[model samples]
Target chain A: MENQKERTTIVLFSGELDKAIAAFIIANGAAAYDHEVTIFFTFWGLNTLRKDEAVNVKKGFLEKAFGWMMPRGPGKLGLSKMNFAGMGPQMIKHVMKKHNALSLPQLIELAQEQGVKLVACTMTMDLLGLQEEELIDDIEYAGVAAYLGDASQAKVNLFI
Target chain B: MENQKERTTIVLFSGELDKAIAAFIIANGAAAYDHEVTIFFTFWGLNTLRKDEAVNVKKGFLEKAFGWMMPRGPGKLGLSKMNFAGMGPQMIKHVMKKHNALSLPQLIELAQEQGVKLVACTMTMDLLGLQEEELIDDIEYAGVAAYLGDASQAKVNLFI
Candidate 1:
């Protein structure tokens, strides 16, 4: 018998790795329930979708001045905030390696394995001067209109 | 010289246990960082604040049609979603137990221990016909205006 599937869609608007991780966790959790899931990555969230650009953790005083103190790319995230303090970023790297939850890369791999749809926001790409070739191959391009269409039909719509 | 303190706040928007667990995780994570944290429960998220209500796990057709289920209260959630697969709720119950993650009750207890704020939504209470007496002892009442006023000054405002 064919099973009826429920759709879960989320519009993720984050450029930070930590924020991205939060969205991915929820997506993965919902997918585990066998729901058809779609994630629309807009604004900063689109950075993780870049194919050639490595997810770099931000660093240094200048970056920190601009609120870039968190790890440069998607490589550093997931330690509970309390655990993040005291331990240097290097230690975080080691722990993440041990736990296998290292940033967007692992999340991307997991999302692919779990069949979560990845959509990039064209508006963000244009604003960031990102070309279509810059995004990861697994990603599909969609404008806000397309994303809204998907979101309208979803049983659950989340903005994170 | 006295230093400025970093503020912490967690906003929980979902009535479900898994969503509630995410809030607990973030709340505890903040508390671990020695930041003053607050958890604002609003709308459907009020399910966690209901002292008499237990966690609702979706059992297949039998439980859905009938009311037979496990985990007497919110404290019992995450059990089925964690490990149970074959024996119905039993598999879920086992998986959650393996992780030692906080159940709703335990999470509430931990919030108490950590001095995490548990703010109940005033409007939701009136809408749902919930009285103050129906809630747990640690709850406080705040309107949406109050929550947003505080959230504006907060470094992080999460809707979980």
Candidate 2:
């Protein structure tokens, strides 16, 4: 069981706010069990780990133009087929709040505390006009090939 | 631009109430613009589409046993980081509500009215002991192969 725990890691691919949150959720859960966690933030997922910038930034027209159409904030993400008009986001936020789940800011803290490896996609940074200085401190830069190399060894690899 | 609209399709992946609301917000927006729409549900996502299930169900040990380690409702989901101690789910809910996003219930109605394709995961059904009868009548069942087969051709595919 100890070996299994150590061996288990979740490789996350995220460029969106909600997906980033989802990766953190799983990372926090795994860390709660004392598992080694590594999150490879590629493409848009790098936004959260960006340094000196707000974690959640509004998507630009270029992003929208490329068919990346999701909203900027967690509250703006669409649910799977069960939205109550525009009310699904509120209900999720409300229910999560009632249940004492961690907010976005706290998740970041927990991830850091839990020793989650936050990796940023270097290629994405180059394409998006981001620099290493722009990402949050402690972020590692690697190519997708490197991410896949790490992910291939992980027991749990999630493309969030 | 017109071609882009036809290529755009919203896929709802969260079965949770709040996430579902988020999904609807995008769906409604897409529909209002007359964009092609398709929603795919998997895992817990299938719950929202359950035909006769109540919006509120008691969470048992099974939920903990299952993958749901967090609050089972929208309010408990912790929008940013799953940090609920210093923060409150109600506060999150309030912020989302103030934003005029869809409630869990409202999104479902909008999906139906807007003619979104509701696809549920068969694999999740087997794992959760859910049957087609347990789901809302509007859902269609598809295995991963089937869902991917359809999604492969989609210009836009969202995980929600």
Candidate 3:
């Protein structure tokens, strides 16, 4: 039993930089511990997977407004607290750099390099009018069923 | 092996109402599924465990200031997003009530009633100058080791 590999599934629900950092930190830790890890990106979480550059996608007015209002990518995400009208995230980034900690993009890269499965939710994409081209390459696209399938077999599951 | 009881551990690290609701919802779901569940409240998360009424406890100026700056209890906690000077939480609560969803305090009560083990981080308590008497009764007090003990065996572990 001790030799059996563990499995972890995380449902990334929040798009805030701090929460994304926590998710990646846990995912990295689980991967380091020899666990199979999967992160399901849904709703705002999918924003973290978006590329820094905007993708030209046709959309209705509301959809376009959503695209405009929400952060385009991980770098634009605001902090969950002390956001003083957008200054907090920059301050946190500076702190992270000062401490030589990995940035969100770097953490995402590390997670991918460690073979962590990243799944973008199809339902949310449709609702938010996000296109696949807007996100980074090499990620699986699935619905909640895919997430549940992984979660059912997981020894560790988290919704963050 | 199939008959062995599965365990779930949640590290409730945020005190915001939205996050707290999510944690309780997940905790309740796990408990309903017959998983042995534990929620380790640390740092800001301890604010959720605080009683609404102020306790007659003495403290230093900094300690009192800390208490004053933070939400007194779950009832006073703000939302993580769209918190337009505290109106967002009230609006969300209204919507929750309209949808017949459990309120945050009710969810906490339900989680407790469902046999979820609530563990308060002692180190964070000392750091924040929180006293046991100020929190809701019938909770375990421990440090990181206790949380790790639970997490080490948990079939589902979450940092929320």
Candidate 4:
């Protein structure tokens, strides 16, 4: 029983601002409860791990276009709903500040501090042409099999 | 030991056609593995359970507007990406038919036949003004707490 810690895994598949926030909030909450948590970022969810600055990495035209089109990082993601252009993210950020809730970046920091494992899906990175240098540091890189391994054993797994 | 069924739970939170198909595919896959699967539909996911035809339920102006704006059922939902107005869903349906893949409605039907528990979020119903008559039959109406109870015991829980 000592080695059997509670485990939780989350697959963040959406790039929307609200969904990412919800994913992190739940991850942080689970980590606080002493569960071993992992957030597997795939598809558009990879945008959450990207650096805000443009990285000078040579890529094929389609890959470059994908990288250009996806959001740079947590700050630039748009809302899944009510995104009146870029205003929805601004309003949500404003409200979050007003309510003293931790920002997305801050939530990531907290999750890292809480020892929640952050894994970026390597297959998605390859397909989208995202380089490790273009993403934030301290996160591990892996494939879907690794995620399934963690998920099959976890009592609370979520695809966000 | 015979009574201890492997449990899995999925929270379908997106209303898009592709996302719904993915949710059901996974749910069906798990159920095929003999896992007791529960798919808790919340927010826009409830649209998947809506009847193809509108029910003549009296509702407030906001509720009526919401009902009008949201998709009526699986056939009416849009794709999350590459949704060129309404053409994307049509193209996906065509491809699905050609590939002999189960359509979204058929997937839901298979889920029911596999004894997968299809649950609609009751709190969301109150907020969205969706009445029981508006949804398809045989689904249990529940809230988040009920979902949590199931999720806590399940080896896999996903919020899609």
- The top-ranked prediction according to DockQ is 4
Q: Give the alpha carbon lDDT tens digit for every residue of B37-60 in model 4.
A: 999998678999999998999987
iRMSD in angstroms, per model: 16.4, 10.7, 4.8, 4.7
Ranking by DockQ: 4, 3, 2, 1
Docking quality band of candidate 3, CAPRI definitions: incorrect
Output the worst ten-in-a-row residue range by lDDT, candidate 1 chain A: A63-72
Between candidates 3 and 4, the one scoring higher on DockQ is 4
**lDDT leader:** 4
lDDT of 2: 0.57
Model 4 Cα shift for residue B19 (angstroms):
1.9
A1-160: candidate 4 lDDT, tens digit per residue: 5588778899999998878986887788777767789999999999999999999999999999998899999999998865779986786676567557788999989999999999999999999999999999999999999999998878888878
User: Candidate 3's residue-wise lDDT over A1-160, tens digit each?
Assistant: 6776788989998989999999999999999998999999876788999999978988876467657767988899988789888999999999999999999999999999999999998866765678899999999999765665577578678787
How many angstroms is residue B133 displaced in model 2 relative to the true structure, after the best TM-score fit?
Answer: 13
Model 4 bad stretches (over 4 Å): A2-5, A11-17, A20-78, A86-153, B1-3
Question: How many clashes show up per model?
Answer: 22, 58, 1, 1
Sum up the clashes in candidate 3: 1
The C-alpha stretches of model 1 lying farther than 4 A from their native spots are A1-159, B53-73, B76-92
As for DockQ, the candidate ahead, 1 or 3, is 3
Candidate 1 to truth, TM:
0.44
Order of all candidates by TM-score, from best down to worst?
3, 4, 2, 1
Q: Lowest summed-lDDT stretch of 10 residues in model 2 chain A?
A: A66-75
Models 1 onward score TM values of 0.44, 0.45, 0.66, 0.63
